[model samples]
Target: MSQTTIQISQELQQELNRMKLFSRETYEEVIWNIIEDTKELSNEAKRDIAKARKEIAEGKAVTLSDLREKYKIQ
Candidate 1:
């Protein structure tokens, strides 16, 4: 595996050191959890946008005026 070096502040280094000693497993798990959550959100956003476009193409979507009225806007 290739190794990379990064620069960090003293405060961040101390916090990482404490996490390494106190919760090594959780630290790694948290990183993966964040990555997975980001991936899921990205996928959901793409799906929603695609569905909206399809609705527009099929003439199933409402106009901007309808949207404003639906939201109770003037």
Candidate 2:
């Protein structure tokens, strides 16, 4: 893969360093993780979320309290 160099502020560099998952993690990996987190959900995921919301509105979805009572959990 081709590589390019870009300049960033010292503060930004420190911030990116803090975002690393491990000491050996590269800045590219950290930036990619951030990009992935901000990406829009897939069409299927969006549809599933909308369906879940509708079910919740219609009271078709089970509540945590209900599950606890049904399973005899305190």
Candidate whose TM-score is highest = 2
Q: Global lDDT for candidate 2?
A: 0.98
Per-residue lDDT for 7-32 in model 2, tens only?
A: 99999999999999999999999999
Error of 2 at 57 (Å): 8.8
Q: Which stretches of candidate 1 lie over 4 Å from their true place?
A: 1-41, 66-74
- CA-lDDT, candidates in order: 0.73, 0.98
lDDT of 1 by residue, 1-32 (tens): 58566687899767655655345555455546
TM-score of 2: 0.62
How badly does each model clash, as a count of residue pairs?
A: 0, 0
TM-score, one value per model: 0.33, 0.62
Task: Tell me how far candidate 1 lies from the true structure as C-alpha RMSD in angstroms.
Answer: 9.7
Candidate 1 has its poorest 10 consecutive residues by lDDT at: 19-28
RMSD of each: 9.7, 3.1
